[model samples]
Target: MKPLYRGLASATRRKASRFALETRLDAMTTRLKDVGEFGLIERIRRLLPGAPDVDVIVGIGDDVAVLETGGGSYLLATCDCQVEGVHFLWDTTTPFELGRKAAAVNLSDIAAMGGAPRWALVSLMAPQEILVESIEELYRGLGGALAEAGAVVVGGNTAKSSEGLIVDITLLGRVAPEHLLTRSGARPGDVAAVTGTLGDARAGLELWLRPESGVPEEEARTVKRRYTSPQARLLEGQCLGRCGAVHAMLDVSDGLLSDLRHMCEASGVGVELEVERVPVSPALPAVAAALKADALAWALTGGEDYELLFAVSEKDFPRVADQLLQETGTTCRAIGRFVDRDQGLRLILEDGRRSSFDAYAGGWDHFKAT
Candidate 1:
């Protein structure tokens, strides 16, 4: 009887110890919202085993992971995911538009690396109640967008989700070794330029959210088109790479200021942005006025523009800009210049006053709690 009691007591103690350990783990486990998307990515990167191979030219940090194929060219791979409620509203955009956007976003990353998109794989998550016709329309849009970029849908997967829809696309591209642009090549005095205008998409989103915002019909349509169907600057990026002038390049999917900061950080440099030099579509100002918001603010912090943001040597900027404009018929503007790291990121006002760029910290963080 004594031995039996001792055995039971020991078993109880083991159960208690296990429960305490689990409790402690629950307490120590950090929520993803607290860490944010970038922080979570950093943590995951730290957890990943180190790869010392030279074939992995760029990994984890940049827009795309560049791999040396030893075939005189480098391969670029990138992927992007879009959530239904988070990235778009069902009422605001159709399934077709969402599919196109998912593909375009991934292609934009490939373009940012000065590569031409060749193939894509799309994975989708949807509810069982989702209409089959809607899914077909979505595929049609995806097919069209890929065809435009000369990319094909090679393979993908589908799963039923309990919640909102999810579309993820992985794109593969190629770039010449000499023309492989990255975010680490910018230097002090390099001119920062962007292809096409900014803020139109943000303004369009605002209008979509606030239909009664009194935006003109024509202007609203134009801005909404910009949002629903963003054109990736694929040709422009290839031209920039071939021109031998672009130092570093990235796409403006994360807002101009945020993406520019990414370039500066990777290059260990800073930036001085001329606020007035930032380009905006003709429709953005009216939309801003109707919403009583700053047009420049949208241009600075709004994401999903998908334009090319690149740095070029000051001497080569004019020739590069001219050539790009001539070749693509896209408006290219030099909105800023790189500075030394100690100088810090800044924004120059119209009155010739410079201020620390504290007004806008970042664009979109996926793990942020609303």
Candidate 2:
């Protein structure tokens, strides 16, 4: 009887010890918000299934995945997601604009890869109480944007959610192997350049957010139009990719500095940005003046511009810039130049003074504190 009682006590002790260990582990586990968006993505990338197949040329880290399709062509695939409160305000934008924005975002990813969009698959999630007509309007907008890019939606999935509307689009595109532009190809001497203007979208959004801020009505409308209906540089991307002069290419969906850092990281190089050279639309200055904000700050950190930022070889930059302007009707300006990694990332201020870029090392992080 004594031996049996001792055995039961030992079993209970072991069970309690196991529970305590598990409780400590649960307490130690970090939350998603603590890690932030990029950190979470890095963890996901590490956990992803092993080495990709032979046909997979570019994988997780790029804007779009490049897969060999044979016949000297590669398939570019990318997906983007937009949530109601996070991406846009429902009251400020129509369903048509929302749909268009959704489609355009994914198309921009393909454009970043120098590919022509061909097909798309959309997935929508909305509450059951949502209006059917609103959904139809959204689809109409998506269709129009896709048509502009010569792409058609083949299929998609729909589901019911308890929260606000959600949209996800996956775009498929094709590009010649030689015309493929990636973030990893920029060398030390490449010129850093961008298309169209920067910060207009951000300025537009600010005006919309603060209508009483005394911004001109017409300028507000123009900037708001830019924010609502952003343009993807499809033609410019294709031209630059095929030109063989551009070394690295990406779209400025994130802030210019953030995206530039991405390119530098991938290429294992550094960049020096001439602050004054970053272009701003005519409307941006007015908006900045009214709001008492620095337009250059917006140009550096404002996002969702959907403009192309690429690095061109020094020898070919002049010709490439001229050809790009002629072919695409978009102004391509050399804003900076790539440098050896040891130089690190630097910003040349308007006063001709150099500053460490760490001060501006911030952008739209999904999990970052608002």
Best by lDDT: 2
Instruction: Provide the TM-score for each candidate, comma-separated.
Output: 0.92, 0.92
lDDT of 2 by residue, 259-319 (tens): 9999999999999999999988888899999999888988999999999999999999989
lDDT of 1: 0.89
> What RMSD does each model have against the real structure?
7.4, 8.4
Identify the runs in model 1 with alpha carbons over 4 angstroms from their true place: 1-25
What C-alpha lDDT values do all the predictions have?
Answer: 0.89, 0.90
lDDT accuracy of residue 217 in candidate 1: 96
Provide the clashing-pair count of each candidate structure: 0, 0
